[model samples]
Target: MKILVVGGYGVGKTTLVGAISEIEPLTTEADVTEASTDQDRTAGTEAKATTTVALDFGRITLLRHGLQLLLFGAPGQPRFWFMWDDLATGALGAVVMADTRRLADCFPIVEYCERLRLPFVVAVNEFDGSFPYLAEEVRDALALTERVPIRTCDAREPASVQAVLITLAEHALALHRAQRPLTH
Candidate 1:
């Protein structure tokens, strides 16, 4: 199954993909150049030196579920948003990474998934020194419906990333089953 990891700039989409991927993840990251200083907002992520220019690719096999997930991390900046449609073409679902400090940054990604009718789960990336907001607070802030699953995660941790992925997979599966036509 193909799953997309998407969010705003510096939201840790690349890190999440790399953390859980069994193989060496392929990243199209480039150093943050001076020219983009005006285009890229670095308020909460001033230390972030690189940005994903295109996408990040990774893969993980879930032995228990007999599934192989092809992970695609979408570029977060608005300039590269044109690539999102292509990345989402065959994706079964998505994990929308969120930074509580810049919660608004993820709004577009969540809207995109909803507009595409793509099942998704919100994974709040818990950065150091960031406020500890409960999952319910995030849901309320995002104006998300109860059906949308939300969880706090550290993108750098494999177990946490795995849990987020599992939530997305289960949510997608449930939606698929619900939409299937009943048969004799």
Candidate 2:
């Protein structure tokens, strides 16, 4: 199943895709502005020069059932929202990464996934060691469900990134099962 990694500009969508992608990812990199850097990167990612303009694509093989996942990173801009629906088709689920600096950036993506009734989990990418706020507070602010897993990820580690995919798969399987019609 394909999974869409979506978030706002500089929100680590590309990094997330790159981290989990078993194959080298295909990404659209473009120059970023100083204004947007604060919202996207703080310290660890300060060296950032280019940002994804379109999407990032790659694949990963799951340990369970040898299931394979195609990861797609959404462009962080609203204009690219047009491609979001298409990218999401047939997706098992999504990991919508968020930044504490700009929590609002994640709202649209989260709402879109919900509207589509797609299973999704939120990951707060730590640009630096410090979190401006607590995870519970952020979850409250987003009004996310208790069952929707929220966790932290570095976006540079393959093992850590794979955990996100595994989590989504669990949620997706549950979602589909719940939607199955009851037998008479």
Candidate 3:
């Protein structure tokens, strides 16, 4: 399965990819300089010293189903959005990571997936402690339809990241089955 992992700046897209990947992930990360910060649209990412300049690539093999997943993570800054289309192309599905502190940052990614009719799951990256909102509350805030699944996880934890992937895989399968015509 080919999947794209995307989210806003400093939302843990790269961390999630690295935690669960069986192989050493390929990342085009660069030091965040003053110039780089100037280009960022949102605030509170000052603590982030490095940013994914191009993309992050990783691979994981699901032992249960013997399925191999190719994960591509997009750069979060708006300036790097040009790469999003290329990364998204031919992807079976996508996972949009969300940070409760800056919830609005995920809007673009959500809209992109919806516009392209790509199956996706919204994973709220719980930082340190849990957010005040429930999954339903986040769904309502993002205006996500019932078809989209909302999950909360700590991206730094391997098990949590793996669970998110599992959820995404199940969602993709259901989407595929629903789209196919019934056969005798």
List lDDT for all candidates, in order: 0.93, 0.81, 0.91
Native-structure RMSD, model 1: 1.0
Residue-level lDDT tens digits of model 1 in 52-125: 99999999997998889999999999999999999999899999999999999888888999999999999999
TM-score of each: 0.97, 0.86, 0.95
Name the top lDDT candidate: 1
User: Could you report the Cα RMSD, in angstroms, for every candidate shown?
Assistant: 1.0, 3.1, 1.3
Candidate 3 lDDT, 58-141, residue by residue in tens: 999978889899999999888999999999999999999999889899898899999999999999998865456799999999
Winner on lDDT between 2 and 3 is 3
Over 4 Å off, model 2: 33-47
Q: What is the lDDT of residue 57 in candidate 1?
A: 97
Global CA lDDT of candidate 2, please?
0.81
Better of 1 and 2 by lDDT: 1
Cα lDDT of candidate 1 equals 0.93
Ranking the candidates on TM-score from highest down gives 1, 3, 2
Residue 133 error, candidate 3, Å: 1.7
Better of 2 and 3 by TM-score: 3
